[model samples]
Target: MRHRLVTRGAVALCILVAVALIGYGLAQAMTTSHQQTVQGTSENSPHSGDGTKANPRRTRLEVGLDGCTKGWDDPGAGAQVFDIKNTSDRPMDVVLLGTGDKAADPHHDPRKAQIYAELEALGPGVTRSMTTSIEAGHFHFSCMPEDGPVVDGTDTNVPQPSAELASSLPSPVQHAAPATEQELIPYTQQYEEWVKGQLPDIASQADQLKDVIQRRGPNWREEAQSIWLTAHHRYMTLGGAYGAFGDLGDSIDGTAAGLPQGPNDPDFTGFHRIERGLWANESPDDLLPLAQGLSNDLSSLQDQDLAVGALEIGLRTHEVSEDIATQTLSGVDDFGSHSGVDSARAQTEATQKLVEILRPLLADRMPADHLTAIDQRLDAAQKRLDDASAAHPQTAPADLPVPERNAVRSQIGQLSEQLAEVAAVTDIRRAT
Candidate 1:
C-alpha cells in the first residue's frame, strides 16, 4: 500500500511540471503575436509612436464634380486624419479652412478664412492623408479642380469643448488669414513707384559704363567695372518687380545658364555677358555694342509703365533672400566678376525694403512677436554681410573663410524662412 501511494505521488508531481511547461509555451506565443501586431501597425501608421495605442479617428473625404468633401461627416472636435481622395478626372487641390466666428456656410469666402491644412495636386483616383487637430469652429474643405472652379464641401460645425477638455487638447495649426487683392493694391502701387524711381539712376550708370568702355584708357577697364557693378546692384534692388519686368528682366540681367551656346548664345546679352567680356580682356570695341544695348534697355524700362502686381510683391519678400542664399553664395551667378558678395548685399537691402512695405499689413495679420523675429533675422543677416565686407573688401563670396561664409549663409537661410512667413501672410486669396 505504501509503495502504491509513493508512485501516485511521483505521477502527480510529473503532471504539475507538464502543466507548467504548457503554460510557458502559451505565454511565449502570445508575446510573439502581440509584437508582430505592433510592428505591422507601426509600419502602416503615419503617426505611430504618438504614445497612444489606438489610432486617431479617420474620415474619408471624396472630391468630385459634385463637391470637394462629399463623404465627410462631422467627427466631433479632436485629433483626426483625413483620407482625401480625388474622384474627379483631373487633379485637384484641397484646403481645410477654419472660418472663425462666422456662420457655418459652405459658400463662405476663403479669403477671410484661416487655412489649417492643404493637400495640393491630388491626382485623379489617388488618395492622400492629412493629419490635424480640430477645435470648436466652423470648418469646411475648398476643392479646386485643375479644369474647373473651386467647390466647397458641406460645412462641419464642431462644438466647443468644455474648459477642462480644451485645456488638455492640442492647439490646431492656423496659418495667417489671407489678404484681399484690393487691400494689397496700395502696397503694390507704392512698390512700383519705388522701382520706377530707381530706373533713372540705373540708366545713368549704364551710360557711364558705356562711356568708360569707349575711352579705352589704361584705367578704362577699372572704371567700366566699377560702373557696371553699380548699375547691376541698382537693378537688383528692384527684385520685387522682376516678374513684372518679364522678358525685359532677362534681357537686362539674365545669366547665360540655360542658353544653348552658353556665353555665345544670342540671348546671352545682358550684364553677365558684358561682365565676361570685360574680365576676359576682350577688346573694348568688341564689348561696345553690349554696353550700348544695356543702356538702351534701361532707357526703355524707364518709359514703360512699371506695374508690379500684388502677388509678385508678396513672393519677392522671400525670393530676394532665396536668390542671395542659393545663387550668390553658391557662385552660380559669378560669370567672371566674382561680385557675389556685393550682389547679396543689394538683395538683402531689397528684402529689407519689401518687409517694411508689408509691415503695416503684416502687423494687422501676424503676431507682433513674429514680426519682431523676422526683423531680428534680417538684421542678423545684414550684420553678417557688413562684417564680411568690412573685413575682406571685394573678396568673392566663395573665397571668404569657411566660417565667415557659413555664418552669412546661415543667417540668410534663417531670414529666408522668416520672410516666407511674411509671403504667406500677405498672399491674396481668391474665391471662385
Candidate 2:
C-alpha cells in the first residue's frame, strides 16, 4: 500500500510539471505576438513622437492677441495657416514674420523681419484666418494692439532651417513683363471706346425716365424708376473708366457720407439723387430736372477723349473689387435704392471683362491657382447676391436676413482677398 501511494504522488507531480510548462509556453507566445504588433505600429506611424516626418504638415497656428498671450510654433515652411484672435476690447493688427539675422535687435524694428502675412484691422473679439505658403526659415509673431502694448512671443533667434524645409519652398514667381506704351495705348483706347458706347444707352434711359416723370401718369412713376435703375446698372459697369472720368465720375456716382452737406447736398447728384427722390416719394415734378441734368451730363461724357493712365487701368482689376466690398457690399453705394447687390454684380462683370482682356498676359505670369481661386470665389459671391435678391425681392439689402447678409459679407471678403493679388501678378504698378 505504501509503494502504490508513493507512485501516485510521483504521477501527480508530473502532471503538475506539465501544466506549468504549457502555461509558460502560452505566455511566451503572447509576449512575442504583442512585441511584433508594437514594432509594426511604430514603423507605420506617419509622424514619430520626435516631431520628425516626411512632409510634416501642421494644424493652424493660433495667435493670441490683446496683451493676453503671444506665442507660435515654427511650422517649418510649406503651406502654413494662421488663426488670429483679438481678445481685447479694441482692434488688433497681427503680423506673422519670418525673421533673418537682422531682427535680433529691437531697434531695427519692422525692417528686420519680413512680414510673410498679416491680418490688418480686426475689430474687438474678431477672429480671422489666413493661409499662405512660406519658405522654411526663422519665424516669430508680433501683435500690435490698438490700445495696448505690442505683445511678442516665440524665441526670436530661430535656428537655421532644415534642408528638407528649404527644399519644400516654392520657386520665385516669374512676373510678366510690363505692358509697353505701344501695347497699352491700343488696349486703353479700346477700353475707353467701350465706355463711350455704354454712355449713350445711359443717356437714352435717363431721357425716357425724365419723360415719364413729366407725364405724371399713374404708372409713369414706376416706369421712370425702372428706367433709372437700368441706367444706374449701365453706369456702374463703366467703373473701370472712373479714374479717367475724374470729377465727372464723382458728379455721376458720389455718395453723401464724406460730404459736409450729406445726402441732401445739391452736389449729391446722379443715380443716388434719383434714388432718394424715388424712394422718398418726392414730387415727380421736382425730379424731372434732375433726370434731364443726368442725361445731359452722360451725353457730355461720350464726347470727351478721356485718357487713362496704364497703371491706373491695370490696377482697376483689384481696385474695383475693393470698392465693391467697401462701398456696395456695405450698402452705402445704394442706400436709397437697396440695389447694392445689383451694383456688386455690375462691378464683378466689369472686372471679369478686364480679366478676359488681360488673360494672355496673365497666363504664365500669375499663379494659376490664384486665378482659379478668384474665379471660384467670384462665382460664390455672385450666387450669394442672387440668393439674397431672390429671397427678399422687396427687402432692402441692409434689411436682409442676418444669415443672408453674413453669407454675402463672407463671400465678398474672400473674393476681394483673391482679387487683391491680381496687380502683383500682372506686374501692375502705381504711378511713377
lDDT of each: 0.70, 0.58
Best by TM-score: 1
Error of 1 at 44 (Å): 21
Per candidate, the number of residue pairs that clash is: 0, 0
Judge candidate 1 at residue 100 and give its lDDT: 70
Any residue pairs clashing in model 2, and if so which? none
TM-score of every model versus the real structure: 0.80, 0.59
Q: Candidate 2 at 359: error in angstroms? A: 1.1
Off by over 4 Å in 2: 1-183, 428-432
Report the C-alpha displacement of residue 252, candidate 2, in angstroms: 1.6
Query: Model 1 TM-score?
Result: 0.80
- For candidate 1, lDDT tens digit of each residue in 383-406? 889889889877889899999988
Q: Which 10-residue span in candidate 1 carries the lowest summed lDDT? A: 24-33
